[model samples]
Target: MKFRSLLIVAVALVAWTNVPAKSASGVPTYIASAVTDSARPPDDKAQDAKRKPDEVLAFAGIKPGDKVVDLMPGSGYYSRIFGKIVGTTGTVYALQPTEMDKAAPKGLQSLKTFAGTPAYPNVTVLVQSAAAIAIPEQVDMVWTSQNYHDLHDPFMGSPDMARFNRSIFDALKPGGIFLVLDHAAAEGSGLSRTDDLHRIDPAAVKAEITAAGFEFVGESKVLRNAEDKHSLSIYDPSIKGKTDKFIYKFRKPLS
Candidate 1:
């Protein structure tokens, strides 16, 4: 009897020790134990760029098996990162505006190259008009980086912008997240400087996206810079590649 009791206690202890750690949702955590600590772009060249991959992923709240859409995924920069985070079980859809084929020929070539490579085997590149991107169903997240202001560009126009946001709203599963990051411009300026400065006012972005039926979840200062007066153009030789930026995270209501 004594021996049996000892054996049972040992078994219980072993089982408890082997149990996996779960996240807030009660699902087993899929944290990457080891990630390549490589230097990020924008850092490679002294350009004023967006957030680093790890920082961006954390802010976007990415996880394995989550379906993600990378809007205007130029050169598959963020697409590759999303693919790795989601793992093989997850799907990453890289959306490129058909207009970009003409507007950004270099980016188009890069997309094709990334699609054909095995490194990003799980990414699917979709060349669609910004107005309407045909995705199967609601995704876990829709992410746009440094490109929202482009919606107001004369080439892309208002019609396409409306369609783009509407499509994203429709594509998200209830309770899905929409993450956006762009260079920060002066307050109350709206998107007027987008063409000349390559930046947008944070408030304008919030109003525009929220009007699309998304709830303002939160914002992050991980990429904020106080020294930036938001007066200079993002491409001005002085701050061109290192301008202050804003990060916004929004969520679709669970209706």
Candidate 2:
């Protein structure tokens, strides 16, 4: 009887123990550091509540001195954050689709001007075709936030996903991370919602990246919303700032 009681207690103890607060808690140190850094633009800091940059970057496993490529850096939100986190010894490629200049000239110019600033000397502006991403050299991490769904849109010109994923696979050093975070679509929605709702099925993303030889390390639920119905555009006024999102971490296999 005593042994049975002890066994139950042991099981309960194991179940009750939580992941370290730093690992799965409120905010990661790297994120907090970057978010609070005076170098971050005031406007980018304004979006912190909605974007949760710290938690997202923490879950992505970014670290000091790691080289990064901020895929589709848009207005250079994460690019700027990464530039701060990676510091002087690190490098950040603030990448944008070449078409950005045609579609959103201001955004392209914003990225260029930010990269040229003396404040973030480690950052470099990289304009390229998203369909054929060219990152110049291997990097420690590639971060694509909120733009993975657009890679499937026809307007992006039917991206050769096979080639795109392969390029990502080749760009990362062995065991380097590929962090993808985007608004979520309803379960089983597949790619249908990508163009219409600006969302993607997390499962589809996992399958595609795994096929490209990346190991699915894990996901973080910090951005999840139980109330989210996963319908409507991510920009819908009601759901814009509070949309359900998923963050997936993939790693290249070490040879």
- Over 65-167, each residue of candidate 1 has an lDDT whose tens digit, in order, gives 8999988887766776677678878888888888766788787677677663666677888888776678876799999888888878776654455566777
State each model's CA lDDT, in order.
0.76, 0.86
The most accurate candidate by TM-score is 2
RMSD in angstroms, all models?
A: 5.7, 6.8
Clashes of 2: 0
- Residue 195 shift from truth in candidate 2, angstroms: 1.1
In the range 51-163, model 2's lDDT, one tens digit per residue, is 88887787787877899999888888888889888888899998888765566677778887768578888899888887778888899999998899888987777688878
Q: What residue pairs are clashing in model 1? A: 47-241, 48-241, 48-242
For model 2, the stretches where C-alpha displacement exceeds 4 angstroms are: 1-30
User: What's each prediction's TM-score?
Assistant: 0.81, 0.87
User: What is the overall TM-score of model 2 with all chains considered together?
Assistant: 0.87
| lDDT accuracy of residue 134 in candidate 2 | 82
In candidate 2, the residue pairs with backbone N, CA or C atoms under 3 Å apart (3 or more residues apart, or in different chains) clash, namely none
